[model samples]
Target: MPLRALFGLLLCAGCAPLSAQDATRAPEPNTRVPAGVVRYAPSVFPDRIVLSPAQDAAHGFAVAWRTDATVAAPVLEIVTAGDSPDMGTPRQVRASSRELRTENGIARHHRADVDGLLADTLYAWRVQGGGTWSAWHHARTAPAPGAPLALLYFGDTQNKNVSLTTRVVREAMRHAPDARLALFAGDLVSGGDGEDDNEWGEWFEANESLPTSMAVAPAPGNHEYFEEFEDTPRERRVLGAHWPLQFALPGNGAPGAERTSYWFDYQDVRVAVIDGTSALDLGTAQAQARWLDGVLAASPHRWNIVVTHQPFYSPRAGRDNALLRKHLLPVIRRHAVDLVLQGHDHVYGRRLPGEAPTPVFVVSVAGAKQYRLSEQAQRTMRPVAEDTQLFQVVRIDGAHLRYEARTATGRLYDAFELRDDGSAKSLVDLPEGRIDERRCERAKTLKGRADRCWE
Candidate 1:
């Protein structure tokens, strides 16, 4: 974890080569296993079942899964849960299936829409892979309009130690069992564009409960993009090979930003996922900017939440996303976005609640990767954490939004409340006992040790 190695790791998404001083540093560990060698085996069972919010969550939901090539026609069996003990017969919905070839092998990806669902009602569903069937899973649709809601937010759970990262996700879920939605602010895997099936598998396995129950909303991060060759740098990169096939997202977004950048409403909150990487690299910034304006202007929800991989107000020095700030921040501010959740800096940071119109900007990390806090971060953000893995839970009720950040060990690290009046809003910092910040002296000593760090 020398300075050179740190720079290489931080700039890996841009495909930057390691410096000469980093040549002797140990290579980052690869966590993929043989079992993750994505291959197709025609079995009756389906895997990777994920549930996502449709444009209209009250009356619709989307499900996506993977099956072997033999499963020519994938199907979903869904039914309303009965009041009594006996379960009723389910109506079958045929799913659209597609073949996706990856470095591991070829597999069939299937997706289906469940429409006309009763609002706030319990429903059971299962997927069919040829003659095989998955276990019945249940999920609840969004409640009546304006009802109170809670959700969990996670930052980058990207690489090397998924086992360690999975625990944090599970712990967050355990702490917020009532949460109806889970938001992943990008970089679900270390080598998404490279088709690292093992890393993808580990990520999927880590959140087994979410896909079956809670609706998942994910944004794409720079690491999610991979170049044609590992050593080629960032000259050529594309969205991860697994993205489109892995999640069924809303299509109402910028023409080219479907699935990756979209907006959906749940109860009183409108959550918008913006494609920061696309804006930064693909020249989709203007399109997304206009779409964002329209989405927010048209939203009737009580709270507006925006999720992106890169922070407009960067928490790390020498990592400012000025382009994003210039193109998207104005729109975010104009719309009075209530909360902006972000990742990619590998640290936890929050700009103290300020004057009117400025949304709560937060950058956090939930994986094992750690980064040092910069002078700019220390000077601007209060209650920032370096070398700490954290998760957030947000609850929305009428005009009030409550946010809490917690460590992997269930310690409360940060908390705040944002209350909206008819015309403007107010911010209140919630006091909590937090662990002492990890400093450079201790961090430098831990470099290349169990916990990677350096100055």
Candidate 2:
């Protein structure tokens, strides 16, 4: 089949083509993350450290992490940092606790929602292991509502992630340490059986060091829901049973997908999250379809970013997610979304915002897994294939949003800027950097081992 067939059309149902963002020269090269951060112990287990979906309210942030049985009630504390180590003691804010368990056995995870915070303020935090603590990670929260912002996004983190994935994520953090929001659009694990559990652990440990001030908004990958079944297709399985307990989310559902699909307002941006599994596996799209339409209709925010696991449009050949496109694309278009993020293909992709006011749809992977693109891959701007590990940093400042995708070596791969001036187009390309084509064709299309690519 032709590559175009693999990804069905991703155009808006009734929207007309808006003018494209004037493609400008890429931004300057990003600096590397200091060596002090991104360090880990062989025995320390910090799988899947992350910021939750409920970050809209300025003073709040959420995080979750897993540990070896020896680690106690995993806790996170925030402290302020000065110009140098010579600076005085920092402020400390601890997250209230909710203990969670891993379906794979033995490994327990910690989920915390930190509220009552200050906006655009610099703070350092550490995830505590019993009496001891993880590294002193640093970050800042989103600007006050109606303020401009920036964000970074990644797709899947599903592979030999224990040691490798950290560098890719750190690369993004180094580019913009105070990043306001980070989006993980699924496949954070492999999700088949053993791999899903293990990879989630690795993925968490990978990012715990950088979320000091920035917040992350993640969607559950399809692998997150692989529980067994008795009737449906006999071979197919339901999503896993442990997701709800793993992370505490805002129960703000659209209409039908209460916990599975939800939305929250972050300052000037209203981000919506969904579980494609519910829509695809069960006939629940009707409810979420209505819910999404309502959420968008009710949104008063200046920006909208939708988070899902399946791409409305695929970057590789032979992959199809038509059902999702049928139910959600029209809604996304009608809402005039600014961004739609997903991961299934282990690559980096961004579609300049749209047939509507929305300008970009991106897919990024943080795990060790990578995939190949088609001959016309260049036609897909900022398409980074298998072999190269990467992550993005998106900062929203005033009316403009700046984004930089940094490679594992801390080099800027691609950068763009978007403005909210009611213009149809908004992608400002970077000036110069390495575009690793080394692993461009790392793996053939759909190699059946996508399972290995996860936990």
Candidate 3:
């Protein structure tokens, strides 16, 4: 297929406008129908079954979901089995509901918090919505600081996002099944009906199998915002109801973020997630910034990695990530961050630890969407994928962390290893393959609208 069509195809494919629903009624976009495909609704849609972990990670995890109409209180429960098939059915715990009202309409958000969980242990859980419970999801508590850990990171899958992004993630999982954490550098979804409930469902469904295995650490991207919602940008759009509830994160709230923003110590890793979208565009930047410094300063983990949506520097050459540089750079450099992960440019860019205050900043993209790399990114650039669909598997062992970029079809595009010998150091590079040897690298512009492709 032509590159232009490919670009459009890869960009995010989500809930289209709610086909002129009644202006005076309906809690959500009144769907002529719910679930499955239709000739009229030619595009694929998602179901509202997002299961995440919330609350104190050591003792409790929460589950959340949305329904067309008000649903009865759900029963959140769990069970135990050390990877045994006979782990018996998970038991039920607690359930509650929150009314989510939007211009589109209002719907009930169900939440179930499973309490009395074992520290640093694995268990299975599910929730009962209308008498039927969700499938058993397995998870473990966050490791206290000083524990060894691993996580997966992906860039923006916002525009032209397709099933290819799905395979990239699935392939990454196949590469590292034991990864305890999943890190998204933002741009989870594209900029459009940012308030659409099932839009997030598509994102969650993509990672459902993995959530059953580990907790996810998320950062909001600009696209996560909704300018059409009101005069102001509707960043995050209550994604928390799903984020906090499904991930069952730590309540050690970030210095200023309270529950909406927090930090948690997982093993020897103190993963500090910052909501750049909320802080920068939605009116919480200063507070979150102050808390970020405190979290980094207090982080006693052997490896310190900050995950956010926007990058302090863009390897996209002519591109600039000035806003974040002014806001977050100093803090990161001062604390000596090992790696920075971000997505927005719809391409892959990595920076070395030299001139930059931090060791390395890597930009990655998951999903089928592709972009041409900047010319500046070619020579000065270390590794860049201007127009490729990719994802990364990050494995952390002892004082060492390794990352590999693989194609959605599961080809090892590039691999790098880092050893912490007092400081971050890179070993020999992995063998260069066909991907690394291609000229389809950088182009003047991406396929669709230049603004959409670049953004």
Candidate 4:
């Protein structure tokens, strides 16, 4: 393949335009696609079924789905998958439904919260919507307290979710089949308003069956918030209605930010999901900061991790999250967070803790969107990549945590280990058989456009 075409496929920088904040859409004009080519519409049957972790993943969990507005009464049936030939009797739970109007059409979102489940047990579930039953899917609860756990992390599957990003997610799953939870570091879709049903549909389709088996904890990004009105002189953006409607999240977040900002404990890990978009743009930064400090202060888990959309240290050139750095960074550093997983830079960067009680900060992207690395990133980040699609797998045991990053083709790109010494955590780089940092050569000028490289 030609360099530009290869770059187009590897880094989906060609799909949709970057976020609304970017001055230019796709820098390259030839990568644009027609609207009619992308088709991901809603249907009468239940689709886009996703599983989210409850506050206590071992004892409770939730599942959310979508269907036509006509499905008045949606139901979910779950049964324990035991060693016997026949599956055990199923328990039926009535799901709460809400009607939402979108660009595609009108659809109803149904969410069912299940509690009192046995810890570390596998359960088979199916949902009834549009008078049809979905295929039986399997999900496992978190292991017993202090038990070993594996987690899957992704940066931004924002652009070309179905066409290009699906392989990265699937390959990650194949690499860690036993992962219990997955964390999406915001920008799950490219739609700025976040109400585009086609984009949501494509994101759901891209994940395939991963959400069904492993619990997901997603943080909202700037792209998830859309302006309330396009013609209004003033800009007033609100959280997309589809965001809260599609995924059933824990309501244990701070006031004014319930589902978007919350925390959940899985096994020996406490994952704090923050609403960076709301905090930076919507005047809830201080509230979320207070809430985060409280959450981190009271955490009893062996390992504490924070996941958000914006990064304290951005990897892109001439980009920085001032508000996030001002409000959230101190709280994160004060609490001595173990890991900070962030996105929105469309590049890979990792910073290890030094003499200060700082956490291991990592910014990664799982989609095709690519960006130029900042000069600061070049000097600060030890191992970084550009124009590369990556996924992360983390395993946390009693006192040891293993982290690994791999490309879309399943090549180990970065690895590290952290061991807790009861007083503080120590990091050790695990760089064996890892590939060299990937970068593109600079080109003076392109035909008519100012300097641009082939990703």
Candidate 5:
């Protein structure tokens, strides 16, 4: 029987047709919302405002937001910062808009790229949806070349409890108020596919305290891709519909992997965001590997970091991204990448100064979801944490890079520093009091594992 005919027959018999892809599509048991609940609201005014780094941060930045269909034309108002408190005349730019039909309702997503701004200067901008306009938000352009820089990093926040993630982000912001950029290591939502408007809304709501002025750099995780249909035989998984519409990321990446897998330079650091889902599932790993090497080789920035969903060195025993490690690890080692930030494993683990002078690999979680530390992780990964929500603040000043990881309640968990002395670099682990390690009680079923608590 033909595949289509077989699928039709299965439908008639009330049996679901499974395909090769369907076998691999992991179900997201973490999502707690009921089916058909529309969470995304397209208000008359713009909301979910987000700022992303431009290809050139020194002079450009991108903003994206959502509004109701009633607001046909989307516009942005930008102006140079003035000494006076009063608002000044602004330059208006017409933004391109698109309509997205979610489970709840249709929403108009708008994005604008503003350029020709002064370097190392502060600017204020706002968006308009119909007659309503957003409040003024301020952002600073990238500082002069080789200037000091700081950034906030978060791991997987995919959880039924977004407030936990929200608290972590808020606490991190309080600690690093001057951070120029915020990087999410992926799995930003509990929904594997980005189709859950409510989950997306929860994520945005959690980050309400984060200023729209700061640039956000996000990587895609497995949860961001969902199987289009379960009844069909050809179970194709694709990127979430909201992934691209919500983020106006840099586009300087490989041909097939444009916005999702791209690289950008900010001051003295070069950051690369790679799509691990595409690499592992869509056969784009080779392309990403080649692009990574080219980007690392061409970059002139003193510090190089790569962000992806899966770690090059898997922290969990059974969970392993062997292909990613095989394809990208060599390039990362050869180029001496400074740091690799990753998420997916719902635990915190890092391998600093591995074997030789290799890049520091880190996997962390910022959400309430907790997983058991693998036996391998327990033996190898130093200061591993389970059932703990945490965030990291990294500061780079010339030759020195300092990283601090703190729990959601603002307790220091782990700290480290990497110093580059022109010829060689050294990793110095800073002393910090961390909570006790969490483990799982001997259990047989999924429910038992889920019910496991902190030790």
Candidate 6:
């Protein structure tokens, strides 16, 4: 059967293509103060507001935010968004709150699970902390099962988040204004531990209020882990404190890995997030592997995508993640996963299906960090980029999945189309005249002196 026959030919049903003019336009600089320049301390008002998808995104969703301890009990108010000024009677839900101690001070985090929503419905919501209500934000539920879908995927936004990464993130949003979800491959923060409040603040500020409307699914990166000393010479690296306190993820993940390793469905796609850091260093590799095998074995969705912080195929020279690949690659290959989106190498490389075990393996960096590509990657990955920040837009309609990677300023960097006709899959690279491959030899100023190659 033809792929279009198997799945309807709606190709990004609700998404508008980024016009050639818009694609090549210059990126606007962020006006907000960079998180690196100032401290982002929690206050009496609600901040860091974010939304995450539920196990069944069509029926439910999760929202989380941070506030000062004085707020006590916070509440979330929601209603079907309407064009009229009056939103009718609103539904109120009390949030579950938790107290957290950060380097800045003590703050409270609140999460509310909003369920029983109609599929593909648009709703408006707001959070209240200390009698102050945040500006109402709009969110739409996922399309009905088997419907066309669109989403955004980002690589590491670890360094210079507000200053440098925000431009890339905003540019991606411009290209896919109606994207339902924003997926992060991890290393969300540069701080490897201690949960730097300033960095977290910068990350949220960089994203602004975009996450309140779109859901976020982030995998754990090594930068989100650190060693803790407790009367032992060698302390195990543990997940940072900011992770759980900031995002309210679905609790339906691997037992040992919990939030860091989980899976969720959005329309016909099943996104499985793997906790590569904990799996490799925290002795949970086997457990996650088993859990992953089971997850993929039981997935009923038409497309399966795995998101992680560490790449199965390393793009940077001398940065191979052998253990991670050994533990997870087999499971990924066995299940014939459609795509494996990853970060951690701080370079961009996309290996097509035949070249790699999976149909597509992409390693990209969205922040200021850049690294030299390995000889293997240069030879295998056709459109690799370095010294460049990029973002990807992925769209799934019936039997076709279209992927486009664009530069921070909105230029089309690389693109491809994947079609699955129930039994077989085919891939076609889409770019004919892509911008020049960004490598260190053309760089005027070197960044990350020790880790990144200056050439």
Per-model TM against the reference: 0.88, 0.72, 0.76, 0.89, 0.88, 0.88
Candidate 4 accuracy as lDDT: 0.83
Writing each residue's lDDT as its tens digit, candidate 2 over 85-185 gives 64465444444444434444555566777777787666666666645566666566656776756567777776555567777777776776545767777
The segments of candidate 2 whose C-alpha lies over 4 angstroms from its true place after superposition are 1-55, 63-112, 121-140, 146-148, 211-213, 230-236, 352-357, 374-386, 422-455
Candidate 4, backbone clash total: 1
Best by lDDT: 4
The digit string of per-residue lDDT tens for model 3 on 1-455 reads 45443444354332121122212233322122245532121011112444334434566565565543345566666777556667786677656666655333555566665667777777776655553556666678765554556677888765433333556678778877877777777777654643344445456556647655666666767665555455555523433333443334456555435555666656666667777666655556666767778888987667778887766666554667555677677788888777777776677777644753345678788854555566566655567765566778877777677778776677777777767776555454556563653234121233223322332
Over the stretch 1-455, how does candidate 4's per-residue lDDT look in tens digits?
Answer: 34543444344333322222332334432213345543444566889899999999999899999888889778999999766657978999999999988776788899999999999999989998776899988898998778889899999988778777899999999999989899999988877533377778878888998888889889998878887776787878788777998788998997677769999889898889999888878888889999999999988888899999898888887777899888888999898898999999988999745786349999999986677677799888879887789999999989999999999999999999889889877888989989999864322112212122322
Q: Residue 258 lDDT in model 5?
A: 76
User: For model 6, what is the error of residue 127's alpha carbon versus the real structure, in angstroms, after optimal superposition?
Assistant: 0.8
Tens digits of lDDT, candidate 6, 310-350: 88888887877777777888898889898899999988999
Quantify all predictions' global Cα lDDT against the true fold.
0.80, 0.62, 0.60, 0.83, 0.80, 0.82
Backbone clashes for every candidate come to 1, 45, 33, 1, 1, 0
Q: Please say which candidate is ahead in lDDT: 2 or 5.
A: 5
What TM-score does candidate 1 get on C-alpha atoms? 0.88
Relative to the true structure, candidate 6 reaches a TM of 0.88
Task: Please tell me which predicted candidate would have the highest TM-score against the true structure.
Answer: 4
- For model 3, how many clashes? 33
Off by over 4 Å in 5: 1-39, 192-195, 231-233, 432-447, 450-455
Q: What is the lDDT of candidate 1?
A: 0.80
TM-score of 3: 0.76
Best of the two (1, 3) by lDDT: 1
**For residue 243, what is the lDDT in candidate 1?**
88
